[model samples]
Target: MSDPNDWDFFVGLGLALSSNLFIGSSFIIKKKALLTLQQYGVRAGAGGHGYLRQWLWWAGLITMGVGESANFVAYAFAPAAVVTPLGALSIVITAILSSKYLNERLNILGKIGCILCILGSTVILLHVPKSEEVENFEDFIIKIQNFGFISYVFILIILNIYIAFYYGPAHGKDNLIVYIILCSTIGSLTVMSCKGLGLALKDTIYRKKILTTMILQVSTTLTTSVS
Candidate 1:
């Protein structure tokens, strides 16, 4: 296992940037589609998933899927640290699109804040370490079984359960941040599962051991389902 060459690195970067663009645009488009649904159909907050019937919503979803696919491939060739910070660009893009297309207002302070975020992301990207290729499934398993990682996963589970049973009913409806916290916490686990699955698939393709890869694939699937 070796570091990706310069060409692979740049290709991944380009894919990530493209994903940011598509994802950002999808946000605005989806919002518009939702608004359209709200005008003639039940709101999503009222237990309606009627947005599914809208072609615009479907288009937005397809765009988002494309973006995620690009992001998935990007991770194969680049470090998560490098690719993850680049996601801030999606926020910047969303803000700009929301203002232009959705008529959402951005105050001067907000503009300044967005600029600062971009600058911070750029600095992080510049200094981020490259990804080290894992040699095999055994090494990946060892890494996953680290005490610190296990503890972190345990804490996340406990917190997620607590939030679902206690904080969610009390404050989730009134507070947007509650759902954001839930998504962020659960998303960490999901991302880990996806990364493992991606690596396993890559290894399986390289090694051509179908039986072992099948087992790894099943385990990864179960991990994702459990999470």
Candidate 2:
């Protein structure tokens, strides 16, 4: 584990979490898209451009699958602690890709946020925490409480009502867009976490190659010694 050569931990953590990061992002975008369609009065039991939607969904799933596979491989080679924080680079990834493909503009504020996120993630990874086998529901509840869950829930309910009213008589695509984004964020997080858990529980291989490499790296040596 101390060796620069042993990159297994980092690789594993990175692979799994990166998959999560991408999956989460894709879901977020996809959700927004579906919401637009909903605004078009196409909810459940409807088929118009349904073929296009299906195609888009499948494409997203395929991309997600490739991401997940790479994540699994990373997990096999590195530690989750090492890999997850690298996911902080996701915003950067999105910004660049979006700029190139979608012609989205990334302002200075966004650039700063992306940098900070990456910095924070790198800090977290340097610490190299051991992966917890299970989430502590108690801790989860406490954290939610600290974040003012009651207030959040209240606001969410209010938003739902507003959306309902706003979209009435004639549905507005905006509401659907917002709703889809919310759903996607939740769904992607859930699915990716589940996949990561499933892989973490299985027998692992390909770790030696990583560990060996890590040990040889001077930074890792210094980093481990100081830690």
Candidate 3:
């Protein structure tokens, strides 16, 4: 039989590609739904969650969820270096969908840009290094408990809380940048936790079972929620 690791690598590649397709299509669907909502109700930037009532929006959200789930599974089986860059496929997909469905004109320059994105993504995929050596779940716990990482997580948590509670209600409504900053801040931490969680789960399933993996997954999930 072929090596199990090789099997996992191919599986992850397939899942990542599938995720890109679904997520890319979801963007167009959601945008259409948003446009429809804008015509019928208040805009989202003005405290309107009316998009929730749009069936297209819900469909798009469901599609996106499936994509994200595939992405999570891909992470469990492949290195971040391999899986992350594959997300560029979604950009290409979205561009194509936008031109087709939204009647958005793709200028010559835009076409070149899309081609360049595809070329870059192809190069990255072709040259991506193998997945890193698997480590014990205890090693992850030690890394997470390190003083520097702990302090970083603490700071992110405090900042997120401050922004959500104090600054959000006051300036977030008018200042679009504030919301972007808030989301970006939390997003960084969430990405880190997800990487760690993926590795832990991967090790637990494929290697020796470790109780710490489950614990780490739960804790990281909670941290993601907080973020």
Candidate 1 per-residue lDDT over residues 128-227, each given as its tens digit: 6544554355566777789998999899999999998999999999999998999888877766665566556656677775535554675577555854
Candidate 3 runs further than 4 Å off: 135-191, 204-227
Question: lDDT per residue, candidate 2, 45-96, as tens digits?
Answer: 4655552555555666667677756654564345445554565565577676
RMSD per prediction, one decimal? 3.8, 13.7, 4.9
Best by lDDT: 3
Best by TM-score: 1
* Model 1 pairs in collision: none
Question: Residue by residue across 1-227, what tens digits does model 3's lDDT show?
Answer: 88767777778788889999999999999999998899989999899999988999999999999998888778766666677778878988999999899888888998898898789878977887555554445665677778998898799889888888999889997999888988777766665566677777777687866655465757577645844
By the TM-score metric, which is better: model 1 or model 2? Answer: 1
Badly placed stretches (over 4 Å) of model 2 are 1-7, 13-57, 69-80, 129-196, 199-201, 204-227
Worst 10 residues of 2 by lDDT: 206-215
Compute the lDDT of residue 25 as modeled in candidate 2: 60
Q: How many backbone overlaps does candidate 2 show?
A: 36
